[model samples]
Target: MHRHRGVAALAAAVVLWASFALTIRGIGASGLTPVDAAFLRFVTPVLLLAPWLPRALRAVRRERPGVVVALCLAGLPHFLLSALGGRLTTAALVGLLLPGSVPLFVAVILAVTRGERVRGRRLIALTAIVLGIAATAVLTTAGATTTGIGVLLAAGFVWAVYTIGLGRTRLDLISVVLVICTPAALVAAVLEVTGALPVNLTSAPVSHLALFVVLQGVGTGIFSTLSYGYAVRRLGSGIPAVIGAISPVLTTVLAVPLFGEPITAGVLVALALVVGGVITYNVKPRDRAGSALAGPPPAAGHRPHVRGLQPHLTTGVVEHPAAAGQLHLQ
Candidate 1:
């Protein structure tokens, strides 16, 4: 039953994740800058989850300062990079490159830092992901720029760091949400007040504002975070991760009609390779002893050891906020 719930939650979160890519790309029509959209994204969660701030702060104090900083990097900075990259490139590339590159970056980070070996299927998965990203950047003529590809790839690496840092902390769902959103909201507010980041919140069309507030704020900010985390807890990171790999494809398909983005042969090839690689990476092989060795489903919030990259789940369903930013590829 719990696994069923997790699958449902994860499916919903993937849809929201795709919507994030769409909305970020659609911001120009709404008269909101990337910064403005990010402000709404960060601030909404901070205000709605304000009651958990104190506890989250206390937890932060107990954590290594680096982990907290990593969490913050994954919030606003990641969002801005993604938003900018989406603007410079097609929404299809934004969806494909951002999340698709995460596991590859995670594997590289782990291999370099922790000496975790990537052999067997893991190696093949990473290879496929690399080829996919390369093909998209080099072959796709679907309005993608070199600068945009670089920015989204950078965003992927940052989220990879956040995923690693999240595994090192013990903050629960609400606390994780607060810890990431609070500082981001404050920074955005400062930028807005100082005239560094433009604000169209007051004059933007009501319908546009409503769209962003609901999709970016409520859906991506709150619901995706909670649902993805819940899915990880109940299903163990592997299943949800594999299913979540579909976001890029979904986003690409939606972009066709919504943004009139063209789907070329290069885009389709890139999607096939990246999605296949992501699913391959997330799948855990059974041991020689098979189901007997596989033991029962872990209790809620228990982290199961799945080979390759998996997002670290904290207590409760609120792990990392990357899900909200469209990189739920974690």
Candidate 2:
């Protein structure tokens, strides 16, 4: 049976992520520095989701030690790097560039390392993502912060590795997420406590921290942990990837209308291209026979994987081989 629940979860992820852009705009309006903003974003999610620690730790104890370690290694760094990158770059640029980079990185790494052949539809989807992002970039100006863009790009690469790494592991849904998030939260909180943060939340910027709480605690800490796996179980791996293209478009559109940030021609182009790419990629060839009638793609049935470090940021369903306890490729 098609799982509508996964689709709903994916949709929620898209909305929450897009709202992330607006949240940045809100912080900007509040006159906080990007570092403080980024710190809060990361820290809040950890705090809000801290309640899950007991269960998460129990799951960790139940799972293989190596698998838990792998999850922490793969997922934690991505979030750490991405949060740092966001401090350097504009949220719109991050939105547009990050997600667009994942499939490309995944395909190349897979082909080279695992000997997995990249196929037609995935290739086309990749092409569409690039072209759409290019069009968006051309239409809008990200203010000549090429260095910032580079940082975000590196962050994206870290996330791409995380996504691929998820495929290699055999951990269950709760175990996998906890393994990733617990360490990430600890790391980020440590940084905050140690004064690595750019803006001092102790001063005038206290109000902005509340926004951070909302963004991380509700938007990421809670939702992302479950969304990817749910989508995978309900919809399928490929479908969520395609549907995720909606994130950049939705975020950019909402930024201006709701947050009063000016919308640009580039944003519009990006929106169109992303939608087009997603549609093109999701559609199957008529020549192929299938068991069920195609409607809007069903939800995937896997738990969410963190996307904090990628070019765009993310979550996805993953299924690991039963005995491998290692990363699996889709």
Candidate 3:
């Protein structure tokens, strides 16, 4: 049941992302400033990743400057924008703008850059998904100002680019993460040294600070990524990527009980649009003969053909710190 396994992996990713919404909320409530909170998320992760730095060093050196720079943008800046934006707005907005809209961005990027054709059903699916995102924006709380939406959209753009950048880099997950984070950590270290970060960030409740470190560092940073990549391998990245559109719906529903938020008709409608759109996108078209995804398994010795399937970011789970291949997307 490879399909079932893929479903389970995507389900696990959804759960982790739902937790991520709450954790960003906790950071906002704490005494930590945006920069301070960004630093806090990276602190333990930097330390945890220190010993493995040497493994990534060579790749860091040899990789083209432009790719490394793009990775760096996707690394700390992406998190800083989203984490800070999460603080500035509702977690619902954070979930809605980032993960919810990424698939559309991926499709646009593939079409524009690779000359990949989007036709028939895919176009309709993309249209519904875009409408769904628009509906979420319409549900915006009075508290969700222009700035907050801008921040969330910024986060979404960077993450979409990050996913695109993945195809360009040859580095495995862990090494790329290391290369990405090392420069960012250095920048944060400079900020801390310059007294730009809060002087008493440690004074924020130790329990809460520890919560941020553990969840951001270990849970979201490591485990969720591994699971998402696993699903990509099992189902091919296309299915899981489309399935990930449901993350916003899942986060909003779970938040009703966890954060005491109320449900609304808009969210329900958005959920329906997204789910229907994703399912429609995956269906094989009947009118088109020799459809790309409709063929049987290839003969032995022939590499299987796929249309629009994303390359796996990493082969398998990281067995150790030295091998902790990149597990991103959260």
Report the number of the highest-TM-score candidate: 1
* Candidate 2 stretches greater than 4 Å from native: 1-8, 24-70, 73-89, 133-143, 204-207, 225-241, 258-261, 278-312, 315-329
What are the per-residue Cα lDDT tens digits for candidate 2 across 51-80?
776776765666556445545643445444
Error of 1 at 94 (Å): 0.9
* Candidate 3 positional error at 34, Å: 2.4
> How many pairs collide in each candidate, listed in order?
0, 37, 3
lDDT of each: 0.71, 0.52, 0.58
lDDT value, residue 54 of candidate 2: 78
Residue 314 Cα positional deviation in candidate 3, in Å, after optimal superposition: 17
TM-score of structure candidate 2? 0.72
Clashing pairs in 3: 173-326, 174-325, 174-326
Worst 10 residues of 1 by lDDT: 312-321
Give every collision pair in model 1. Answer: none
Where's the lowest-lDDT run of ten residues in candidate 3?
Answer: 315-324
Decreasing lDDT order of the candidates: 1, 3, 2
